[model samples]
Target chain A: AQSVTQPDIHITVSEGASLELRCNYSYGATPYLFWYVQSPGQGLQLLLKYFSGDTLVQGIKGFEAEFKRSQSTFNLRKPSVHWSDAAEYFCAVGRGSNYKLTFGKGTLLTVNP
Target chain B: DVKVTQSSRYLVKRTGEKVFLECVQDMDHENMFWYRQDPGLGLRLIYFSYDVKMKEKGDIPEGYSVSREKKERFSLILESASTNQTSMYLCASSSHDRLIPYEQYFGPGTRLTVT
Candidate 1:
């Protein structure tokens, strides 16, 4: 079955430090991948998506993700972390043109000043 | 900006009470979905509607029903609220056009607690 996995339950980073959140997916076909961030008590906001073409995709709030097909990974990265960047991040996968999404449990990010 | 709104941010109810959780989307989306989020488990789809009066069972549809009387509104019903049913409920909507990769827009979730 198609599924998404976020290995990290929580990650803490110092302000201005580089950040990376890992995601892995298992699917038969070329998958549609996405990253979403949710602040406490708020709905999820789309960060980035990868469907086809360039493996590297850029998202809002200085976030970027790379889709590595060989590794079955789509990892989110940020050059520098801000206090406001602290939030829960989820990785999701969709097959073909379907809208149904399978989401990872999520990784809670904490930024310490 | 796409706007999806849920009727409540927090709700508490007894175990046997019938519960209604409402969702409305301003975007004329053809597809709407209901999901529950727990602490360790990610969001699990409960039900979805493709069009008015059309519904499909999602991965976890037991103990839950849905109503989509109008295009812009979808409601999730809990037949008999149980403590195990206490969860953060999220509503989402997206366009159905196959050409455009559907991007789901989410509403602020309603935290339901069944006692």
Candidate 2:
């Protein structure tokens, strides 16, 4: 079975500060990782995904993540944060041909002015 | 762009009542999924269909059943709604193309409440 763990349950950052959300996964084989964001009362939107080839993946709204094989981590990062970026973020790992994803508990991001 | 739409945005049902949640995708995706979201837990897959008439149980499919009569639509059913089933239901679809297989596009979601 595959699983994802997001160490931070909630994160608070200033509007202009840089941010990083940690994610770790337990998978037997090469993992397909993804980051998704959900705003209050809205469905989730894909921030980015890492399938293969690249260790550093770029996503929408000026976000990026680095996949580290040794550490089993795919952490999302942004140089500057905005108030609108406050939302609940999830990390997921996909395995097998069925395309089933195992998601983390989620990290709630709070942007302080 | 892919568009996934659910039948309702909010629903209130009584305990033991039958509930149906419909999902339709416009992009001709080969796969459709039903998931439930809670406060602390992320999305948990209830059921998924790879092709018409083919359904698979996900991690938490005990109290849920699904129907996929058409390629573009997938429906999730709760035989008897319970208070524990009150949560946000999300519908998503993804292409099965080998090149890009797992990026799922989601609908706005239906918030279901059972009392």
Candidate 3:
């Protein structure tokens, strides 16, 4: 079985500060990882994805993630965050056999001034 | 850009009522998925179809059914709407594999309330 775990339930960051949301997964084969962001009352938008090759991938809105195979982790990071960046972040691991995905519980990001 | 549309932004239904939430994708992607989002639970897949008229159970499939009669449309059904089933329902579609740009495209979502 495949599963995703996000250690943090909630995180608070000051505006213009760097942010990192941790994510780990348990899967058998090579993993397909993705990060999604959701605002209140809005659907999820893809922030980034890592399929193969590069361990690090860049995404929209100044987000990036690194896929560490040995650690079974794919953590999302941002050099600097804006108030608009305050939203829920989700990390998911795609099921190798069925192409389905398993998502973490999500990390709620609160940006402060 | 690929587009995915859900039929309703909000719905209110009584218990035991039959409810249908519709979703449509314009990209003719080979795979479509239905998911329910709850606070602190992230998103739980209800069901998905790889092709028209074909469906597969997801992580949480009980009390739910789905229809995909056309390539572009997928409908999720709740035979007996219950209060516990109330949540924000999301629909998404993607290409079959990475070769075809398989990132899932999501709809704005239907917030269903069963009372």
Say which candidate scores most in TM-score: 2
Task: Tell me the tens digit of each residue's lDDT in model 1 across B20-94.
Answer: 999999999999999999887889999989899999999899999999999999999999999999999999998
DockQ scores of all models, one per candidate: 0.73, 0.77, 0.61
RMSD of each: 1.1, 0.9, 1.2
> What's the TM for model 2?
0.98
User: Which pairs clash inside model 3?
Assistant: none
Record all residue pairs in model 1 with backbone atoms less than 3 Å apart, i.e. clashing.
Answer: none
For the candidates in turn, chain A alone yields TM-scores of: 0.97, 0.98, 0.97
> Deviation in angstroms for B5 in model 2?
0.5
Can you tell me the CAPRI class of model 1?
A: medium
Candidate 3 chain B — worst ten consecutive residues by lDDT sum?
A: B96-105
Ranking by DockQ: 2, 1, 3
Q: Tens digits of per-residue lDDT for model 2 on A1-113?
A: 88899999999999999999999999988888999999999998999999898899999999999999999999999999999999999999986778778889999999999
Candidate 1 chain A weakest lDDT stretch, 10 residues: A93-102
TM-score of chain B of each: 0.97, 0.98, 0.96
Top candidate when judged by DockQ against the true structure = 2
How many residue pairs clash per model? 0, 0, 0
